[model samples]
Target: MILHAGVLGLLVGGTVIVALMLFGSLVGVRILRTWNPMSTSEEQLILERQTYLVSVLVAVALWIEIGSALLFIHTVDDLHELFVGAMCATGTLNANPVGWWVLAAKGAIVLLFPIWLAVNGLDQRSGSFPLVRLKYGLLLVLTPLAVADLSLQIAYFGGLQPDIITSCCGALFSESSDTVTGDLAAIPAVLAFPVFLAVSLLFLAAVGWARVSPRPISRIIAAVLSPVTLAVGVVAVISFVSVAYYELPTHHCPFDLFQSGSAFVGYPLMFSLVAAVVLAAMPGALLMVTQHPALRDVAAGSERRWLTGAAAAFTIFLVVAIWPLVFGNLAWESM
Candidate 1:
């Protein structure tokens, strides 16, 4: 595993991120303890520069981390050509459970990074805003996870044996198998599709209503529904996207969807869902924003963009996920 190009990339990227984040944690500790935007001291000025500088570095590091995750998957899938028994990424990942675990950890970290950026934005634009320490504290908390994710990546790559006979996607995803994959496959498409659509509509309604009314009541409604929307989004991926990609109700192997033959369509659908959720949830998150002059004006514009982008992405997901079912049904009728 260490010998593979993909594994090397992942290890190198993860190592850099850990180092940067560790440095960030130290800077964050200082910032949290003595962050004073108004003070004209040399230390305050240096701290401000350090904050912005580290933020940029962390942003790049996070992007690299995300790319490393995708690369890891692509690498695993590519190995199928070399392994006689492996047919898809599922087989490669199944060779070592830690492979996907590290991927998942990277994903979680990437998602949370945006929120930290948003919080940092609030603090930067508003000198007196109270979230500085909290944001720094979050950096500290995330550092350990970054370290662990890298360790897991290293362990996974070190342990994976290339020639081992592995259970391919068929066995792993077969509905007859008594596993979580099978349970997800068992979800009735008729019921799941409707539920997914309903949740999406509800999420849209909440965001739109909040935007129009701009009241605490409406904001609260959106905030409460955001998590529900994310949950339904997951169900939709499991029940709808997986089924459509494989064109088989009994096969729900997500990693297999990334195979070259599939044109990697799963990438957009999955990432779009994530983008939509994060963007849709931003307005609700902004409710906690302090009433600072710089933030007040800019926030409105940011919220508008988040709303527009979220709505667009959601629409894309709905269309892409439904196209297969609709066309397949039509072809069935023709047959």
Candidate 2:
């Protein structure tokens, strides 16, 4: 199983990403300590050139990090057949519990990498490069996370044993199970669906209003509601969306949506959700820099574009979630 093409790809890609980030962090530290746009000395010129190289290196590594995140899930799902009780990515992850940590690490990168890139983008838009210090500081923080991700992946793949009889998704997702996933699965669809629908609509309204109006309050509302909406959306998927997608109310394995039998619907379902969350959260994340006198005007101008993109992404998610509910034959009952 360790020799699988996808597994090899993930391991190699993770290693390269860590190396790039490590190099970038070394450069980042120097930049943090001595970066000054006003300095015209030879050392300052050298630092400027180094910053450009480090930025490109980190950007490439982060882009691969995003792709590797998705590939990690797909690889695990593909490996399920080797484990006796495995069903999907869930069971494969269960076979080697350390894989969960790998997933967590990858998820963190997925969430943070974009925010960093956005900050870098905002920094590049200015002549003075006002956000340089903040960007390098953030790179230093993220470098450790990249190292952890690789370490966890190595630990996970190294420990895999096909002989282990792991519990399948059915048991884990069933109400009889005592795990958090089980609790989410146990949520009554009738109740969960309404809450999900209400929150989704409200979030859309808030984000849409922000995009159109671009007021401080509207942006604040959208930013605040973005993560809340994503959390609720995940719960709703576990509670009922999966059920609707499968048309079997009792089958609630979210990973199964990625399989061919489901027409690979989970890709679009999750892609839109993540895109919506990331885009919607950008304005809020950028708020960290808005207080900087030099970045205030640039942040304000960029936020409008972010808001516009966020509204469109959120709409895509809403359409994808609602499509199955309306068109599919499954009708929610007590559970």
Candidate 3:
């Protein structure tokens, strides 16, 4: 029964991601055509507008995905029961094939959209917020979030142990029994600190260099951001390590590590971290758009029209997809 439920939940979750990706790709392609002409001025405006709009859209999507993931995690036990019943009714559960193609498609879409936005957005001629700067800033602010996440993982998987005392030093020590699980499961917490620390130091160095020299500090700021940028590179390595070393080989069930009650509590932290990063970046990006010469022209005329249209279309799509779930009927009474 439990196995069946796990499979069912995985199917539903994968379906949702696939739907979102299909819609998002259509939106991306439409936006891309507007820039086919690719003039200096038009291209700059298109990129800036797209950056802000896409960031906002992704932030919204992430919030929804996190919430759904948590809910699915919490209700995993019930799902397991459902799975068992289905298998019993059908007689041959082992022959059923899981949808790996859907999973791969969804993953590609989710990852590619952000890279598309970041590359086009940052590559513009105007001296807007460098991609490096925003990346580093995100790293610094999410540090505490990372630590809290690690602690939670330790609490969840690692069983409690009695405190140990050293006879010579009279020091007490304890080890967490929390075993790491899925790659995605550990990321929000573990990566937060190092990302934050590297970025903060770079920003501080930029400020110091500015005070000491008469030259324009943007180049210095960009330079400081370069090393911190390497943190993004660490993501793949960490994810691989997490899956290879932390996850159990046989725990094919998606929700094995998720606890429903704890999900509502823990999931909110993930949303909060993402929201913080977006909120912090938005104001500066907005200010930069107004001040940067190349961007100023893009905002002036019909170019702004196309940008606004694209943003509005994307927003409408999100509203259509999310509103029903948020306000729709509940199956059970709340505690």
Candidate 4:
């Protein structure tokens, strides 16, 4: 099965990551927790090197996760032909409870990896590496999550039965359906569209203002932008993504976008928004590295660059998402 192939890749990648993380966690608890900055001990030197090694491995593993997420979704979309009632990736995912759990795990892994990178960045900037324990401890925590992700992938793919019929996106995401997605779909475009636009603009404006503002003010804006960006992502589903892909204002089903030509924009647009949030949120590393006054400048410089990157990413998302409505010659009707 296509899903089996995808799950196989995840298991391989996740197992390697979990092993490295376990080592890192052991070092954190037994050595790094008590190591001295001034000690010229052999153990301290080895611990430092081991830390870097774990980081390199984890970073590579995280990169694999990003690719795996896309591959998983693509495989599901491709399997629609084989699935008795699947019309797209969404339908395939709706096939069983395990499917949604797999998706949740994928989302968590993607989101967590960047935060791990931020933690590592904080440790890198600290002269004494005070956050070493925190970083390794986090790695330990994430190890279980990665394992769960692997387990969920196996369960999802294993549960898939070609003989069993499943509901398509049309039925699962329809207005009358009793799902959370259905409720979101039922939100009239009249309201959802404006809210989506307003939220996006607010996010854009806040991040822009943050670029030039003082650190405290910029941090506040960053704090607000987090939730706003999340809201924008949600509305993008029920409003922009659904409408653009389906070419029908009322057909607010996100899965439909992964079908045929619409698939071109679906994942790319979603990825762009996610990238924007990841970039914009990097300045938060400051909270972890504040012990080192020297790193304040480093944090400031990184914040500016990352927020600018966020803006650029969001701009790309806007262009890609609206292209169908403006230039793809999509048929549209008044909301």
Superposed Cα deviation of residue 230, candidate 4 (Å) = 2.2
Top TM-score hit:
2
User: What is the per-residue lDDT of model 2 for residues 288-311, given as tens digits with 9 covering 90 to 100?
Assistant: 676567777787777777777776
Q: Candidate order by TM-score, highest to lowest? A: 2, 4, 1, 3
Model 1 Cα lDDT, one tens digit per residue, 154-207 = 887788776777778788767677988766666766777778888889888877
- Measured by C-alpha RMSD in angstroms, how accurate is candidate 4? 2.4
lDDT of 1 at 291: 41
Show the lowest summed lDDT stretch of 10 residues, model 2. Answer: 210-219
Q: Over the stretch 1-335, how does candidate 4's per-residue lDDT look in tens digits?
A: 34456557766766666666666566666655666667789978887777777778678778878887887788778766767888787778877668788788888788778878776876676556766766777787777887787778777777777776888877767778898777777776567766777778887887888788855656566656765686667666765556766666566767666566664567777788888877776665355464257566666766787789889998888787666667644454443
The residue-level lDDT of candidate 4 at 229 comes to: 83
lDDT of 3 by residue, 223-250 (tens): 3343343333233222222122223322
Which of the predicted structures, 1 or 3, would earn the higher TM-score when compared with the native? 1
Candidate 1 worst ten-residue window by lDDT: 326-335
Residue 55 lDDT, candidate 4, scale 0-100: 77
Q: How many residue pairs clash in each candidate?
A: 0, 0, 12, 0
Best-matching candidate per lDDT: 2
Q: Indicate whether candidate 2 or candidate 4 has the larger TM-score.
A: 2
Model 3 quality (TM-score): 0.30
